[model samples]
Target: MKVPLEIRPGSDAGLGYVKYGNGPVHVLVMHDWLGDHASYDAVVPWLDGHALTYVFVDLRGYGQSIALTGEFTVEEIAADCLTLADQLGWGRFHVIGHSMTGMITQHIAADAPSRVTSAIAVCPVSAAGNRLSPEALTFFASTVDDDNALRRLFKFVSGGLSDEWADSKVQHSRATVAPACRRPYLDMLVTANFVDDVQGLATPFLVMVGDNDPGLDAKAMQRTFLAWHPNAELHVIPDCGHYPMQACPRYFATVVERFLKRHTT
Candidate 1:
């Protein structure tokens, strides 16, 4: 029988998180631009509670932190996560970041190398940042108000998975994310670049990308993350898209656990 997770709400200041497990190895999991900590709900049941503890956090203006506001920069997000870890009394931890927050993982690991054990980036935007054209930037910015646009974007990234899936994700984003937080976050995603800061760092990174995810595919990982971090490794999930934890929970959990196990010691 599968073990039930020991879940708890964050009581301390900084980013709000839902804590799971009671294992010795600590991990901080952050969400993408689309959803909050709930984005990892599908993968929770498959995670190894006996070996690892996870704290799924809500960035400013997202989920439990919806009332918390900030400058909405990746640096600010990284700092909030570190602060939360300090409050939780964790001196060292691993970080798992998805999409936008994936970039934050790099920032955290580079800024505080002694504290971060390793980083797992899922369909991550590189520390170099994703520079979009003016037209593309305008379309992404419009996602805050245009549900259809956001839904279409989700569908495209997930390799046209299904309309139902796309719709669900769009609805989740609409409900959990603050509208005012969207544009500023988008600007941060497009403009933030700190590749120079993370390059040559000794931190180990497991950069995962879905083969079907056109935007952040295996080729993109090789050119950016793998090229920048000397200790980085790449994994391509077959038949998956942007959201592996959501699209292939069991397989995603297996891969993530394998990586964590190697570094936990």
Candidate 2:
């Protein structure tokens, strides 16, 4: 049975989080660019609360942290997560990041190697950055202000399915995300290259890719995350798109929990 997660207010400098379970292993979860903590609602129940404590956080410009002001850069977001952990009195914790936060997860692990025991990224953006055609770049850039465009982009990314789901995602993101932070974050995910920073990092990483996530295909992942990090493993979840936590919650949670169990100290 799944226990309810507790909503905890964050500090002045950190983003708010939903705390789940009371296990020895601490895990910080970062949502994707288009979704907030609510994105993990389905997956939460399937997680092993007895073995892992999950902290699902909203990025500085999204969810409960929308009011907080910041540059919304990957480094800044990583710092915010670290600050939240410190405020919670956690010495060391595992990190899980979805979509854009996945790339941010890499930064967090590299920035504080000793503090993060292991990291997991789900349908993550590559740490090396994305390569988009000029037209594609323009299209994505324009979605910053247009919710309909954003919804269309979501559908395009999710393999042309789940229109209603994508619509809800766009609405949630538009309402919760700070308008100023959207484009900057998209720029970071597409242009910020951290190859040198994460090249030889020893922190273990589990990269979970939804088989249907057109953006992060097997070859793309191999060329980036798998190639850049020394200690990393990849798992492909079948019949899932860019948002596996929403499309296949039970499987997603199980895969993540199993990886954590293997890596837990």
Q: Report the Cα lDDT for candidate 1.
A: 0.89
Error of 1 at 239 (Å): 0.8
For all predicted structures, in order, the TM-scores are 0.96, 0.94
Angstrom error of the Cα, residue 46, model 1: value is 0.3
lDDT of 1 by residue, 28-103 (tens): 9999997999999999988988778899999898888887877999888888899989988999999999999889
Give the top-scoring candidate (lDDT). 1
- Candidate 1 residue runs with Cα over 4 Å from true position: 1-12
| Candidate with best TM-score | 1
lDDT of 2: 0.84
